[model samples]
Target: MLETEKEKVKKDAEALQLKMYINGEWKEASDQKTRDVINPATGAVIAEAPEGTAEDAQAAIAAAKATFESGVWSDLPATERAAYLLKIADKIDEKAEELTKLETMDNGKTLREAGYDVGDAAACFRYYAGMITQPDGHTYHVADPMQAMVVREPVGVCGLIVPWNYPLLMSVWKIAPALAAGNTIVFKPSEVTPVTPTKLLEIFEEVGLPAGVANMVMGAGPVVGNEIASHKDVDMVSFTGGTKTGKHIMKTAADTMKKVSLELGGKSPNIIFADSDFETAVDYALFGIYAGAGQVCSAGSRILVEESIYEKFLARFAERAKEIRVGDGSDSKTEMGPLVSQEHLDKVLSYIEIGKEEGARLLCGGERLISDGLDKGYFVAPTAFADTTQEMRIVQEEIFGPVVAIQPFKDEEEAIRLANDSDYGLAGAVFTVDGAKGLRVIKKLRAGITWINSYHPTYNEAPWGGYKQSGIGRSLGTFGLEEFQEVKQININLEVEPIGWFEK
Candidate 1:
């Protein structure tokens, strides 16, 4: 961008104020503090978000609690709630262009990637809208004169905290389901990318969603997010972020015994066998890690290849990795975009250095891009370190960047062992022409989402989460909607008469 373009963004930032939405009213923080939101693609300040504090977070939670207790939204008929969700979904579609641009500017993902996420966000609202209308309670058969049945109700206020990697998509993953289930919400979008989610709050208001049905407080996690988690009024917290932070939230939420659903980090593995369709395996290997700049929680950063095809596979993967176009996300021709922020780019670069120090082979690009209009942006080339061991930090830890740690396995058994050796069980994929082997291997792999010949195709109808450290509970499909609900058993007596064994 030219000097004038950068200056114009600064001017826009000065004019725009992303305020906090509470009780259907847009307001500033109590102290009137603000934080400049920088565009990672251009390293320019695009806008400013209200830097909310713990008091602000408390106010949001109180509003959610009050609204839930009032039953204005929670007690609405299922069809009514469903209609609101559908409306929000429709609004998202109507405003996809604006939201996508904000997402790209705030999160530094390609326009196409942001566009895909915007579509998925809309689908999430629609999915929950339809799912909520389905039968969820159960009728039971009992003995004697008693009739018993189970009914579901909303679980008061929900504390929704989402990550920056998928700014809008992740927010909808929690918001739509929480609303569909009739629970009021205290939402906290990541401080890094609060722009898109703030716009979502607008859509919620535009659709006439009741005040406090969905409230947003934007600030640092320790202040706003922790306040929501530890608040007694907040009944549940559905957080999607790093594993360490997930653990912290679990501990804090345990004080109030609030239900905690976490979708944490992963060092996912992508396996390629010699017998697999070679071209397809190579293509997905690139897509798995490079997509979202490898910032995905379920990103396949660990590529485990069979010994027979290790050398051939790594060469092709590295060749493709080097060619991924990295620049401003708004550029239609760019295939890859910069990291979300300068700090994150430094973290990814440090991981690359650690990979080299640990005696791994740098087969392709590993340097930060400082030329071709990318000098100001936080851009790094798609990097891969081959001949990695399981003990290496690059192999075990979640780098959350366009960096892959490639390792070779001797056989099928070793492949399975290598895949499941991580502390995370978020996602994994295996590529092989043998369908039976794919199933067999995938079954043994300890992850929540898996693919036979594919890489990244997640559905809203299916459960989305992981085992072990990946998360505590599921967050998509029926399971996701159920997370914000409570179950109650109601029994009625068919006959009022009773026989007494002892004389009165």
Candidate 2:
């Protein structure tokens, strides 16, 4: 067959065979039910995934527990653990194109973004693979003159729940570190976008990870996700999603007294000072929110521009926002794509309405676009609202769409106050020319990760989580590795000790 024919055949095959992986096996849903994975750009069905149930989640938990108890994964040498993660990374690299394409089809993100996500997923595995061999344990000097040491051991049977926005990357964020720390995992991918994870399981099997060491079950939060969070056999639960769902997971894990790590919602603020580099700040501010269709948890959705440059910034920002091309993710020229679902699209639209009602000026876009050929897609024009107040719903609530609200602040104090006024404080950004002012603002900003003149620049080596409702505990870096471990102290006697005077 010709190369074009082979390519067509591959795409066809990807659209057909959607399965769920549970207990290290790929199978159809027990009820044979399937959910249609829609292409948000065209509002068309891209694929079908098995609609998993609570029973599937229970089976996956059982499998993970049994695998952890078997000691194969735990007893494996750190080098061996690193080798397995490396193998998984290699498999991901080999299937990068397939995974990226699947993500674009299912998640309504641009091909460029999906491509980046695939690379990031691989890098996550590779990073954890390298970290597994690092020295872990601390040595302490005791005043009592006895040798004291503390060691970290794996907490068994972790439950990972990833959100739909960045399905593959988020899963890797949880899976790599948990496994690197010597814990087996039962992962539950979002039911709305489950194709990439199903393919990921095939890669795990191809890479020869032991059965049940890594498992995935697809279902909604109420069913599969809740079961994983509440399962008695699960030693820890790491979740990345909305704040409300994170709360539910925390509550459920509390029943079992399981360790929980959450990376939840954010209404992050991007404070652009008058003295900052206007062009750079504008660019970072736009990408921080509009990238990924603004579904990111750390998206700088709230824009706090200094009053001196408020008008100047809004004009340029709105112009740039209007230039963004909203189209199908498969198109290389498309800069933005539709929101994940019609419901989410409507929610965003309602927020726009609320913004208007709350008296924020709709400076650029306020409604869905109905271009000549774009009527069928769930496309919203990249929107900008000027004169937004901190009390406005658009400024306070997370729209989670390509919608930005710009509010003017009198000075640094007001900016910091407005920035920290939200219930969510996952991340924030400070843009200014003066390094001193930037540092001072960062010190006062109540956020987990604060970017100085930059936004959304994350690394595997940095610890990530929030101070308040954004999350509990951290992920990535050594902090993330510690999340999967429990500390134990061993005290040794260097010399014989005398009895107490009273006893004598």
Q: What is candidate 2's TM-score against the reference?
A: 0.94
| Tens digits of lDDT, candidate 2, 65-113 | 8998898899899999999899999999999999998899889899999
Candidate 1 lDDT over residue span 310-416, tens digit each? 89998888888888888899999999999998889999999999999999999888899999888888999999999999999999999999999999998999999
TM-score for each of the candidates? 0.97, 0.94
RMSD in Å for model 1? 3.1
Model 1 steric clash pairs:
none
For each candidate in turn, give its C-alpha RMSD to the true structure in angstroms: 3.1, 4.6
Q: Estimate candidate 2's alpha-carbon lDDT, on a 0 to 1 scale.
A: 0.87
